[model samples]
Target: MSIKIENLTHIYMPGSPFEKRALDEVSIDIQDGEFVALIGHTGSGKSTLIQHINGLLKPSSGKIIIDNVDITGDKVKLSDIRKKVGLVFQYPEYQLFEETIEKDIAFGPKNLGLDEAEISKRVIKAMNMVGLDYESYKDKSPFDLSGGQKRRVAIAGVVAMEPKVLILDEPTAGLDPKGRDEILDKIKDLRKEYNMTIILVSHSMEDVAKVATRILVMHQGKCILDGTPKEVFKEVEVLEKVGLAVPQVTYLAKKLKQKGFNISEDIFTIEEAKYEILKLLKGANNND
Candidate 1:
């Protein structure tokens, strides 16, 4: 859904000695069903910002509006906000606790007070969304599944909620390349099938470049850049200074550009890079 954050600021501890402002009057408007990648260095308030979207952490100052409703106000129910905006924390596998895969996925629907049939339907749908088979794996113990399976089951828990906005915080962290690709692909499919807003908090610039339609760059609790990946990543020095890397291909293209290759340097994905390089090669052939 649409999210409006106007002059938002989050102070970690208001009166305590350790008081620190995590978000500094940040303001932005995110359209519905947009794929947004939020990135920054350690302690850059990226996590704090997503937490505010779902009302996990209330803003010390400013208002948050989701779907035209003021979710940050005192009267808004946190549960309602959470239902519409699902926040899947880093390493969701650590959150799995139910005995069976079915129960684990059903946990969210059960919490929502859905009836037996409805919960069963949601469980099956969510399980399938994560590439889990219901008939074969439903009764199996979640603990017995492989690391990837367990992670999928955990994601199923959030999918069952069918939230309008899905916020994933470092979802692929600590996983092998294959596992990371699997999770990222699932997210891409979920966005396409469900048409829901996707917010990705990640450290991998390549991964973000692959899926994000818009990028939000944070530094020291303030947003420094917000734009398309091509636009944001074109500036290499600022990102490097902030402890972030551009996609490898983008960096390679930038280096080529610096060397007077006359190449388009703003490509974000390998496929795009391949096409651009091939086009340039064809142009050289024509000239020769």
Candidate 2:
């Protein structure tokens, strides 16, 4: 589903001495099936913004339109809005309390009041999407599985709900390299198979560069940059001032350009860098 936010502003403790403005007239449009990475420093309103999208937190002022429905309307039910926007928070594995993986994944579908047959189908489908073998892991205790496996099960619960938009907040927060890769791969797979709009709130520029088709940079309660990965990363100076950085490979590419090598500074991924390097080598060989 597509999302439109217009003049969105949010505040905390409105009448108190500790009142703070968490978001300020932040507006963004996210088209269907777009993987958008929301990046910002800690307390830069990243978390507050995602909460508003899912209707978990109400905006102090502004409109959040999902698929043309104004969720901010007083007449609109938050529960109905949530059905179309599923949020998977960081360390989702800690939320798992079911006796088995199957039950844990089935929880959301069951709450939707789906019948047994349909619920079972969705549970199995969700497991497969996250790369968990239904036959092998279905009956196992979620807590007994490895950290990555437990995290997948937790994510499957949200996937089974089959929301039109999936919002993941720091999905790879504390995983090791292998576990992190597993989660990221599942995210890619989910987008491909489900065609859901995914908003990923992350701190790792490398992870976003690898998967995000678009990036949104937030700072001091305002959205300062919104563009494709290359366009956003090109503002390295601005991002640095906001306490953010582009992918490490993008820095390397910039250094190569400075050293008089013919390389694109926009190259942010290892694969892109390797291809550019190979092309340069091929050109030198032809001259030789």
Candidate 3:
């Protein structure tokens, strides 16, 4: 479902000595079924904004309209709102406390008061989506799983909820290179299979460049940039100024252009760069 935020401003501890404005007149329209990446430095209000999307934090003064209804209005239940938007926080593994992986993954569905048969079915589906074996690992203690497995288990908990929109905050934090790849691929597959809208909060431009169709950049409580990944990354200096680096492939393409090679500047993936370079060499040889 599409989300519309207008004149959003969030104030913490209003009329107090420690008053802080987390979001300063921030507004954006998130289209449905789009893979969106939210980027910002440490305290740029990225976390605060996402919280408002799911009604975890109420905006002091603004409107959050989802699917054409202003749910930010009174008389709307937060539980009902969350039923449509699933949120996976940073280091979600810490929240998995059930005795066994099966129970933990089933926690969300069970909370909805589903029957045992349906809950069991959802648990199995979620586990398999994350590449976890249900037969071998379902009965095992979640605490016994490795870090990567634990992360997957945590994600399965959210998947079990079957929300229309999935919001993930730093989903690959603290993972090794291989773990990061596996998790990203699994998430991509889940989005494709379920046709769920995804809002990914992250710091890695490379990850977003590879997946997100649109990127939003925040700086010090305000959204400074918003566009397609290629459009946003075109301003590499601005991205770097905001404490985010451009994708390595974009950098390499820029360097090649400066070295008198006729290469496309919109390169974000390594494979795209390799293909363009090969074509450029062929054209140069024909000229010779």
Candidate 4:
């Protein structure tokens, strides 16, 4: 599903001494099936903006339209909106409490009032979607599983709900390299299999470079940049001013270019750097 935000503004404790404006006239359009990466330093309103998308927080003054429905309307029900927009918060595994993995995965579908048979089917499907073997993990305790496994089960619970839009906030937070890669790969698989719109809020420029089709940069409660990864990463100076950094490889590429090497400063991934280096070497050999 596509999301449209127009003139969106949000405030905390409005009219109070500690009042803070979290979002300021923020507006953007997220097209269907787009993997959008939201990046910002702390207190830049990234979290607050996403909460408005899923109806977890109301806009102080603006409109949040999902699939052409004005979700901010009084007539709209938040619960109904939530069913279509599933948010997997940071460290989602901390929310798991069911006795077994099967029950945890079944939680959301069951709440949707699906029949027992249908719920069972969804649980199995969700497990498979997350690459967890149903037979092997179904009866196991979620707490007994490894950290990454627990996270997968948590994601499965949300997947069971069959949301059209999936929003993940720091999904790979606190994970080791292997665990982090596993989560990212699973997210990619989920997007391919389900064709859902994904909004990933992350700090890792490397991870975003690898997965995001588009990037949004927020600073001081305003969206300062919005474009494809290549377009956004090109503004390294602006990003750095906001306390954000591009992928390390992008920096390396920039330095190489400064040193009089013919390389594109837009290289954002290690693989891209390797390819460019090889091509440069080949070109030099031909010249020699």
The residue-by-residue lDDT of candidate 2 on 163-257, one tens digit each, is 99999999999889888888998999999999999999999998998899999999989999999998999898999998899889988988889
Predictions: Cα RMSD each: 1.7, 1.2, 1.6, 1.4
Summarize candidate 3's per-residue lDDT along 1-288 as a digit string, tens digits: 999999899999999999999999988999989999999998899999999989899899999998777878888888988988899999999998999999999989999989999999999999999999999999999999888899999999998999988999999999997998899889998899788999999998878887898999999889999999889999988988878888899989989899988899999987788899899989989999
Cα distance off (Å), candidate 1, residue 10? 1.1
Worst 10 residues of 2 by lDDT: 261-270
Would you estimate the TM-scores of all the predictions? 0.94, 0.97, 0.95, 0.96
- Candidate 4 C-alpha lDDT tens digits along 177-233: 899889999999999988999999999999999899999999989999999999999
lDDT of each: 0.90, 0.93, 0.91, 0.93
> What's the TM for model 4?
0.96
- Give the CA lDDT, 0 to 100, for residue 226 in model 2: 96
Preferred candidate (TM-score higher): 1 or 4:
4
Better TM-score candidate (2, 4):
2
Q: Which parts of model 2 have CA positions greater than 4 angstroms off?
A: 285-288
TM-score of 2: 0.97
